[model samples]
Target: MTYPPQHAYPASRTPGGRCPVAPSLYGPEPDGNALPAFYEELRREYGPVAPVTVAPGVSAWLVIGHREVLHLTREEADFSHDPRRWSLLREGRVLPESPIMPLVGWRPALLYADGQQHRRMRAAVSEAIARIDGHELRRSVCATAEELIASFAARGEADLVAHYAQKLPSQVIIRLLGLDERTGQQLIWAITGTVAANADSVNASRRMGGILSELVAEKRAHPGDDLTSTLLGHPARLTDEEVLHNLAVMFLAGNHTTVNWISATLRVLLSDPAFRSSLAGGHLTVDDALDLVLWRHPPTQHFPARYATRDLVLGGRPIRAGDMLLLGLAGANQDPAILPPDGAPVVGNRSHLAFGAGPHACPAQDPARLITRTAVDTLHHRLPDLRLSVPESQLTWLRSPWSKGLESLPVRFGPRR
Candidate 1:
């Protein structure tokens, strides 16, 4: 859901990552914790649909209404998921080396395709993910979560971001995709590079693509019941590139979203004394807490590149063919109509845009949530006294327009049992 970070490309490329064409503004650059307020301001001023520069010289519509998000997702015939349909990219307006390139650039994967192509690819991944047994998945998640917590629970303190929050999901995803532990660990760093849109992103992406291709080949020769093997055995007969790309997409998407949500939820639990006391003393449930996080700090504050397939009006604003559309998932969840002063409804309201909607909605959401919730419960149950090790202001967020992640989450806890 998150776009890659915006950093300078090579000097042969634009060091500033700007097109030098006086791009229209999105706002003051998004500093940690400033983005949500900026989104609020945009909604107040521009209503649901607002215009902002995506990258240098590239402007797009940001859809902030809950209904508008559903509308765009539901009205796929008018709005396309295909980045190839983006006129800017088609006309060479977006630079090949631009930081946003890897995020907005077209790949023959499920997230970027439409019509029958989308259906075919989606069916492959969907069926594969659906085959995962819920009970077994939870067991795997618990095993990983427990192992990680055990390693650090005995220590009075640990940076949960590094030792726990980040490790559990990556390892779970690795196990699901049949990646060996070592290779999975290595690839996690590569994904960090690519998601940050660092100058080395190209090399990182190449490394990821290569590793995934190897996994695809391994599954082909000796298929197992794992998701990778399940994909290999699907009826669509996807090419090596398609298989590798889709797998890579699943891995990265899983890591990016899960890591952010876990850390964000932990940040809230530790930083907000009143909210934590209520949840701790049974006045509020964990489901309520997770739901609030899903609404307020969705992993992707500004999702990338849902292009317009044809000229049309949305939220009473004129949107032309090929105009880039960014779904304001974080904003939509707080749309005035749906969210009031206190916040969103607690229990049983599944109306948030965190997992998106429509045909392209995240297929792995159930498993992803199960894994995250399990991880949370494991830590809380094991280390009931866990709390922050540093001041709240000192903890910085990942400074990426496309992402909402804590740079690190340091904490201390009672010694392990």
Candidate 2:
């Protein structure tokens, strides 16, 4: 099948025609390669609030403008992150009444929850993440980064995505969660495979979920002072199943997003010599690097899907209770009204929606930022000559619309001193 060029828009969006609104928008099959490009053009044509079909029988109001997305994110009354709501709207059946709900018995976590439950989960996780001594975590992360760089620097070559970007975050997260090396690797593989943009990777995710379920049971019987244990200890508030669900979410969310940021950031750095020089000169701190990375290329291109719980008006469009809403985080980030011109590269001290907004925002933002900052800083110091081994066009882009990331990134650099 031929994919559209990077800038082509869908023909139906043009004048005097009704766009196909059903399966084209909401069907389970992966969206066409032209979708992102189409969305870009629609943003130009329809402004921030555009009508799009996300799945079959599931229409959504796409929020493309930065300010509007921010408003929707913070306005819990208008937008609901509850998967049950979305599933009900898409399937035309209430979630709890569905067979899957009974079999899986999914519970909403901070990412998918709102109100007091979300607040409590965020508060608990935030307290733990914030209390982590940055300096100490940085030291450990730096050591890991340095070791990784040393392994590849001598060859003057590396798959930056695999050798450094992917490795560092998983290692740091495993250490932070106090998981054994074997289990940590298993978790990483499961999360990565399950969430891959490729449809072929779905089976891997299923297998990983099975393993995680078993691991959750083990943790219950023999708990330790890790994040898992902390979650389990709060049984009054969270059920055992809820604890497992949250852990699975955390593992998948934390691992891949950080990995994507690092890979994309390195690609950006290699392409922009001035940025690389600035980083090497110590003009850019870890926080600065993270901000730039996030602003330029957020890991998740689309916001977590949300459903309208009640009739509402967004961007002057009437949104029914069952309609799906695809909050375009990437599109929002680039919205000219909310951000500076697209040509300007991100520098220091800017906030973007890479971690999202409001109650459903990623709870692990602090730790993620810390891990990314440490990896970038450590690499810049240790591998001053690091550069991509392959041409940019040769690098593979993951095809899924859910996340923006590279499949692999090969690089060449001078040997470690």
Candidate 3:
């Protein structure tokens, strides 16, 4: 965002020629694991449209082609995101705690809606989020990052995940929604569980919903300049439940995505020496690093659940009615057909589907980038000599394709310079 783009074109169009066919066999269960290695394995074994299990006994097409994902994301009439439209969910196949269920399941939020309903819900969310001015957001993020950094700067070493990365976004969200400390902490836990989609996720989701409902009610009773009050006062006149669910969507998606964005960006800065040196030497802007991370790591590995409205053929693969399609955001970014002839992505080629495209594209990307870049710049400025305490190989990531999240980012740094 702070740097010029490599090129811009209508991402609505498909790449030249036909899609290369590969075996449509099911490779493995998705299990919501967001690993670069797994995405590479899927790309190598199965071409553009490959089959994979989102949960045990639930297989769907993972759209790995860049053009294919854009097409499906753009074709709302053909591909529905509603989980209730999903045949497997109706058949009771997805367990309550299934890792992918929380995302795939229907909620009255903009993320799962389509057509007029989606537009109506999105108006309020977009309007409310748009009120977040960039300058003020940067100020908040910088202050939060500085406060967080000061706590650990004297220690000479700290887990950025525990101290800065995770908490920064949570604190930002708290400020955005204007929630108290106790409620914000509870909300963060609930969001973590819902995104995790494992056992206890269902309960966690309900708790998050309850928290959102309370926040909405409080905002309704007494207004403020925060997002909660903005939504409540919006002309959309959304129902209490609608407002609650929408807020939950914001919390779930915003915090969850930002935490990973921050963590992965920090990981890249701390782990990749050459890349870090480029920034240190002024060859790369912070936005450049963030853009690369967005393409390669993305916020989520597998963008979940778009059900087929009718039978259709995609990338030479048979798609049946009610079949779900998971867009491989990470995989699609590497889709060779859409890449340069060298099979490598040129820097600043945002043609990647990191924020997705079409009607459901992320509405809050600018805010996300601002928060991430501010956090990154603040950290690097305070801890110029920051370096990873462990090798990249030894670091463990949270097994979540829903969010490509790092579990921890431990690092050692010289005292503030």
Candidate 3: where are CA atoms >4 Å away? Answer: 1-37, 343-345
Candidate 2 per-residue lDDT over residues 1-417, each given as its tens digit: 111222332323310113444222322333323445655776766666677653232345667777778777888877776766654434644333321221122355566777887787766666656657779888888888888877777677788887888899888877766678897788788677656533435455566667666766766899776676666666346666666667667777888888888887778788778777776688876567667867757887665566677765555555567556767777777777756566666676456888887667787887777788778767766776767777776667664446647778887766655
The per-residue C-alpha lDDT of model 1 at residue 270 equals: 88
- Give lDDT tens digits, candidate 1, residues 1-417: 221322221111111122343223333356547667777787665667776676556667778888889888877788888888877777877778876666677788998898899999999999999999999989999999888887877778999888888888998888888888898888888777777765677777777777888888988999987988888789998887888888878887888899888888888888888778878899877878888888878887778768777766677565677778888888788788886568635555778999888888889998888888898888888887888988987886665557757888899877865
Let me know the TM-score candidate 3 reaches against the reference structure: 0.90
TM-score of every model versus the real structure: 0.90, 0.82, 0.90
Task: For each candidate in the order shown, give its overall lDDT on alpha carbons.
Answer: 0.78, 0.66, 0.78
Question: Which 10-residue window in model 2 sums to the lowest lDDT?
Answer: 8-17
Model 1 reaches what TM-score against the true structure? Answer: 0.90
- At residue 318, give the lDDT of candidate 1: 59
Better of 2 and 3 by TM-score: 3
